[model samples]
Target chain A: MMQKRTIEIGVGVFVAAGIAALVMLAMKVSNLAAFTNQQGYEVTARFDNIGGLKERSAVTVAGVRIGRVKSIVFDDKDYEAVVTMNIESQHDRLPADTSASILTAGLLGEQYVALEPGGDEAFLKPGGDIKLTQSAIILEKMVGQFLFDKAAGGDGKKEEGAAP
Target chain B: MMGWLQRLGSTSLSVFERLGRGNLFLLRILAALPSLVLRPGLVIAQLYSVGVLSMTLIVISGLNVGMVLGLQGYNTLVDFGSEESLGQLVALSLVRELGPVVAALLFAGRAGSALTAEIGLMKATEQLSGMEMMAVDPLKRVVAPRFIAGIISMPLLAAMFSAVGVLGGFFVGVGLLGVDSGAFWSQMQSKVDLYDDILNGVIKSIVFGCVAAWIAVFEGYDAVPNTEGVSRATTRTVVHTAFAVLGLDFILTALMFGDE
Candidate 1:
C-alpha cells in the first residue's frame, strides 16, 4: 500500500509538471501575455494603402515598440485604410503633430507602424487622429513602374533611330 | 479465370469484417469507461506504468530531435542569411508536426506494445476468463483503466516532448552553434501563434492518443489465447498504430491548414 501510494504521488507530480511546461510553452510562443492586458490608449491613422499591414503588428517609436495595431478598417467615404493603434499609456505624451508611417522590418520582414514625433506643445488624446500618415511602399508596383519607363525609353530610341 | 477475382472479393470482405469487429470492441470499451471513476487506484497504477515509465524515452528522443533541428535549421537558414529565424523554424516544426507524431510513434512502440503483450498474456493464462466467470466484466475490470490511462497520458507526454525539444534546440542553437539567444527566442515568440500552431498540435496529440490506445487495447483483447497469437497481435498493434497516426496526421493537417 505504501509503495502504491508513492507511485500515485509520483504520477500526480509528473502530470502537474507536464501541464506547467505546456502553459509556459504556450505563453512563450504566443507572446500574448506580454501586451494583452497592458493599459493603453487608442489613436487612429488613415493611409491610402495599408498594403500587408495586419492587426497586432507592432507600433514602434524610435525603434522601441510601444504598442500594436488594434484594428484595420476601410473607410468607404475616404477610400482609405483606417488603422487603430493602441499605444501604451506610459508613452501617452506624444505631440499632436506626430507622423505615423507603415514600415517594414529588415528588408523582407513583417510590417509595423513607425511613429515620428513632431515639435508640438499639445498632446493627442485617445480618440485623436494622426493626420500625417505614409502608406506602405509596394515594391512590386515600383518595379513595374521602372520597367514601364525603360520600355517607353527603348521605344522612343527605336523611333529616333528610324528617323535617322 | 475467376479465381483471382474471387480471392480479391473475399480479401476485401475479411478486411471489412475485421474493421467492424474492431469498432464493436471500441464501443464495448467506451461502455466500460464510466466504471473507471470508481476504481481510481487502478487508474492511477496504470497511469504510472504507461505514462510515467514512458517519460524517459520521450524526453531523450525529444531532446535529440530538437538538437538535430537546430543544427539542420541553422545550416539551412544561414544560406538565406536568415539564421535569426532558426528558433522560429525549430519551434514551429516541432510544435506543429514532429513533437506529436514522433512522440506518438514512440509511445506506440513502447507503452503500446507492452499493453498488448501484458493483456495477451493474461488472456492466454485464462485470467480474463476467470474474472468474467466471477461476474466481473473483464472489459471494465481489466481493459478500461488501461485504456483511460493511455488516453490521459498521451497529451501530457506529447507536451513534455515538445517542451524538452525546445530546450534542446536552445542548447544547440545558443550554447553550441553561437547563435544569438535573444534572436532565437524572440523570433520564435513573434512567429508562432497560440491558436494556429500550438493548440492545433495539442488537438492532434489528443486524437492520436485515442487512436493508439484504442488500437492497443483492442488488439490485445482480440488476440487468440496462444503465444504465437500474442506476438502476432503485438506486431499488428505497432504497424496499425503507425499507419493510423500518419494517415490521420495528413487528413488533420489538410483540414486545419487548407485554404477555403
Candidate 2:
C-alpha cells in the first residue's frame, strides 16, 4: 500500500489527464469551433431544385468554406427551394451580383454551395436574396439526358443513310 | 415431475427476489452518497485504485485499436481511392462506438471484478459485520466510495482511450502510410460533429459507468461469506457487466445513430 499523499497526487494527476483528453478530442477530432461560431449573417438564395443540399452544408467561395447553409425551406409561392446561409462576418464583402451554384466536393461526395464573385461594388447584406443561383446537378437526370441524346443521334444517322 | 415444477417455481421466485434486492442496494448507495462528500479522502483513494491503476491498460489498448483501424481502413479505402478519408473513418468509428464500448468492457474486467472481489473478501472476513457492530455503516464507508470512484472514472478513461486512439491512427495513417497530414486532420474536423458524435459518446460512457459500478458493488455486497463465494461473485461481475454493456451499447447506438 502507498502513502495517502501519494494516492491523492496520483488521483489528481489522473483527473487532469482525463480532462486533457476531452479537450484534445474537442479541438483536434471534432469541428467544435465551427459549431460554436454563431456571430454570422444570414443570406437566402433560391434554387429551382436542391438535390441532396442539406442544412448545415458548406457554402464555399473559391473552394474555401466561408459559411454554411443554415436552413433549406421550400418557397411554395415561387415554387423554388429557398436556402438560408449563415456567412461569417469576415466574409461580408461578397459582391451583390455573386452567383451561387451547388457543387460536389468529389466524384461522389456531399453537396455544397459555391460562390462566384461578379463585378459589383455593392456587397450582399444580411437577409438579402441572391438572384443568380444555380440548382444542384442531379446525376440521374444527366445520365438520362446522355442516353436520350445518343439514341436520337443513332436514329438521325439511320435516317440520313436511308434517304441517301 | 412435481419436484421439477417446484424447482422451476423456486428459481423464478429467487430471480425476482434478487432483482428487488439489487434495487434496494442501489437505493441505499444513493442514500449513503452524502457521506462521501464529508470524507473526500475515501473517494480519492478509490479513484487511485480504479482510475490511476487502469490507465496503463486503457492507453495501450487504445493505441493498438487505433493502429489496427488505420491499417484496415487504409487497405479497404485504397481500392476506392478514398484513402484520405482514413482519418475521418478512424475518428468517427472511435468517437461514436468502439471507444466507449471497448473501454467500458476493459474497465469491467480490470476494476469491476476487483471491486467485487475486495468487497466479497471483506464480507467473507466479516469486516462489514465489524463495521455494522461499531455502527459505522459499511454502505457509507466501503461500498459508496468504490461505487462513486467507478462512476467518476469510467467516462474519463473512455475519453482518454479515444484521444490516444486518434493519435495512434494519426501515426499509422500519416507518419508511416504517407497520407497527407493536413487532409487527414481537416477531413476529420470537417466530418465529425461535436453534439452528434462526441456528446453522444459521452452520454454512452456515463451510462456504462453507472451500470458497471452498480453491478460491481451489488455483487460484492450480496456475495456469500466464503472463499468460493467471493470467487464466484467476482466472476459474475465480469460476465454480467459484459452482457449488460454490450446489450446497452446496441440499444444506445440504435437510439443515437439510427436515422443518421
Candidate 3:
C-alpha cells in the first residue's frame, strides 16, 4: 500500500508538470503573436535574387531589425522576387526611393533584407513597392569579382566592386 | 609500434561493441510502442516523473541563463553603440536556440540516468527474466511507460524554461540596465515572430525526449550481470543521452535556419 502511494504521488507530480507547461505555452503563443502585430505595416520590395530569403526573415535598417519579411512570392510577369515586408508602423517615414538589399548575416548565418533609405522626401505608402532592390550576392560571384577586380586594377582600384 | 597497434585494435573492438549495444537499444524503443499505447496510466506516471518534478530546476537555471545573456549582449551592443537593440538580441538567441536545448540537456542528466539505473538494477536482479518466464513482456511494462513519459514531459519543461528565461532577460535589460521597457518590448515584438520561435522549440523538445528515453532504456536493458555492471550502464545512459541531445540540436538548428 505504501508502494502504491509512492507511485500515485509520482504520477500526480507528472500530470501537474504537464498542465503547467501547457498553460505556459498557450500564454506565450498568444502574447508573442500580439506583440508581433503591434507595429508592423506591410510593404513590398522586388529582388532579382531572393536566394535564401524566407517568410519571417528579419528586415533591418543600419543593422537594426525594424521589420520582418511577411511573405515571398515570384512575379511571373516581371520574373522578379516579390517580397512582402511588415515594417513597424512606428518607422513609417521611409523614403520612396529606398534601396532594399538582400543580405546574409555572415559566411553561413541567416539572411535578411537591408533597406538603405534614399535622399527623397516622398515616403513609401503601405503596400507600395520599393523599386530598387539588390539581388543576393552569391558567394562564388563575390569571390570571382574579387579576383577580377584585383587583376583588372592597379588602375581598376579607382572603382570598387559592388557591395555584397 | 607493434604494441601501440595492438592497443589501438583492442580499443576499436570495444568501441564497436558499444555501438552494437546502442543499436540493440533502438530495438527496445520499437518494441515498447504498442505497450505504451495500451497502458495510459503508466504513460501518465512517466509524464509526472520527467515533467512536473523538473519545473523548479528548469525555472531557476533558465532565469540565470537569460540574465547572463542580457548582461553579455548588452555589454557587446553598448560597445557597438547599438545598446537599444539588446532586447531583440536576447529574445532571438533564447527562443531560437538556447532555451530548449539547455533544458533538455538538464533533464537528460537528472532524470534519464535515474530511469536507466532503476531498470538496470531490476535486470541485474533477474526479476526481468522472472517476468519473461511468466510470459510477461518487460518492454511493455517498463520501456513503454518511460518512452511515453519522456515524450510528454520535455515540451512542458521547455515551455517553462523559455518563458522564465524571457522574464529574466526582461528584468536585467529593462529594470537593472535602464533600457526603456516600452522600446525593449517593441523591438522584441517587431523582430520576433510566433511560429519561428514556438514551433522550433517544440520540435526540439520532442526530438530530445525520444532520444533521451532511448538511451536510458537501452543502456538499462543491456546492462551486464552484477551491481557494477548496472552502475556502469546508468552512467553511460546519462553521458550518451546528453551527447546525443546536443548533437541532434545542431542538426535540427541547421536544417531550420539554413538558407532561407
Candidate 4:
C-alpha cells in the first residue's frame, strides 16, 4: 500500500511538472502568436539578401520590436527579397520614405529588419512599401572589401591618380 | 622504457575497444526502439524521474552561470570602455555556447551517474537476468524508457536553463550592476537572435540526451562480475560520459559555428 501510494505520488508529480512545462511553452508561443493578428500599418521592404530572416522576424525601430515580418516573397523580375512587415498601429506615423536595414543580432547571429523612420511629415498608410532597404551585409564580403581597400590605399595615404 | 611503451599501446587499444563497444551498444538500443516505444508506462515513469525531477538543478545552475557571466562580462567590457556591449556579450555567450553545454554537463554529473548506478545495482542483483528468464527483454524494459526520458528531458532542461540564465543576467546586469535598464533590455532585444541561439540549444540538447542515456545504460548493461564491478562501472560511466559530453560540445560547436 505504501509502495502504491509512493508510485501514485510520483506519477502525480511528474504529470504536474509536465503540465507546467507545457503551460510555459504555450505562454511563449501565444506571445509570439499575438503578433500574428496585431493591427499594424503594413509596409513592404525589398532586400538583395534576407539571410536567416524568417517570416515572423521582428521589425524594430530604435531597438523596439514594434512590428513583425508578415511575409517574404522573392521578386523574380527584380531579383530581390520583398519583405512585408506590419508596424504597430500606435507607431503608424512612420513616414512613407522610411529606410530599412537588415541587421545582425551579433557577430555571427541571425538577422532582423530595422526601420529608420523618415523625417517626412506624410505618415505612411497601411499597405505601403518602404522605398529604401539595405540587404544583409555579408561578413565575408565586408572583410574582403576591407582587405582590398587597405591594400589599394596603403597606410591611409592618398596616392597620386595614375589611372586615365 | 618497455613499460612506458606497453602502457601507451594498451591505452590506444583500449580507446579503440571502448569506441567499438559503444557503437555496438548504440546499435543494440536502436534495434530495441520499437519494443521500448510500445511500453508507455515505463516511458512515462522514466520521463518523470529524468526530466521533471531534474528541473530544479538545471534552473539553479543556469541562473548562477548567467549571473556570473553578466557580472564578469560587464567588468571586462567596462575595462575596455565598451560597457554598453555587456548585454550583447552576456546574451550571446549564454545562448550560443554556455547554456546547453554546461547544463548538459551538470545533468550528466547528477542524473546520468544516478541512472547508471541505479541500473547497475539492479543488474548486479540478478534482477535483469531474472527478467530475461521471465521472457522480458531488459533493453525494452529497462533501457528504452530511460533513453526516451533522457531525450525528452534534455530539451526541457535546456529551455529552463536559457530562460533562467537570461533572467539572471538581467538581474545582475541591470539591478545589481546599476546599468540603465532600458539600454540593457534594448541591447538584449537587438543583439540576441532566437534562431541561432534557441535552435542551437535544441540541437545540443538532443545530442547530449542521446549521449548521456547511452553512457549510463551501456555502463549498467555491461557491468562485470560482482558488486565492485557495478560500482566501478557506475563511476566510470559518470567520468567517461562527462568527458564525452565536453568533447562532443567542442565538435558540435565547431560544426555549428565553423562557417559562421
The residue ranges of model 3 lying beyond 4 angstroms of the native Cα positions read: A1-164, B1-14
User: Of models 2 and 4, which has the larger DockQ?
Assistant: 2
Residue lDDT tens for model 2, B1-260: 99999999999999999989999999999999997888998999999999999999999999999999999999998998889999999999999898999999999999999999999999999999999999999999999999999999999999999999999999999998988999999899989988899999999999999999999999999999999999999999999999999999999999999987
Over the stretch B1-260, how does candidate 3's per-residue lDDT look in tens digits?
A: 99999999999999899889777767766776876666677776666676666777888998998899889988898786666677778777776677778888888877788888888888988888988999988888877788677777777777768767777888999989987887677667656666666677778888888888788877888888689998898889878887898899889988887765
Worst 10 residues of 4 chain A by lDDT: A23-32
lDDT of 1 at B1: 56
For candidate 1, give the lDDT of residue A52. Answer: 89
Question: Residue A27 error for model 3, in Å?
Answer: 5.8
Q: Where is model 1 more than 4 Å wrong at Cα?
A: A144-164
List the DockQ of the predictions in order. 0.65, 0.91, 0.22, 0.12
Q: What is the alpha-carbon lDDT of model 3 when measured against the actual structure?
A: 0.79
Candidate 3 chain B lDDT trough over 10 residues, lowest sum: B189-198
TM-score of each: 0.93, 0.97, 0.69, 0.69
TM-score of chain A of each: 0.87, 0.92, 0.72, 0.76
**True lDDT of residue B21, candidate 2:** 99
Q: How close is chain A of candidate 2 to the true chain A, as a TM-score?
A: 0.92
Candidate 2 achieves a global lDDT of 0.94
Q: State the lDDT at A31 in candidate 1.
A: 68
In model 4, pairs of residues that clash are: none
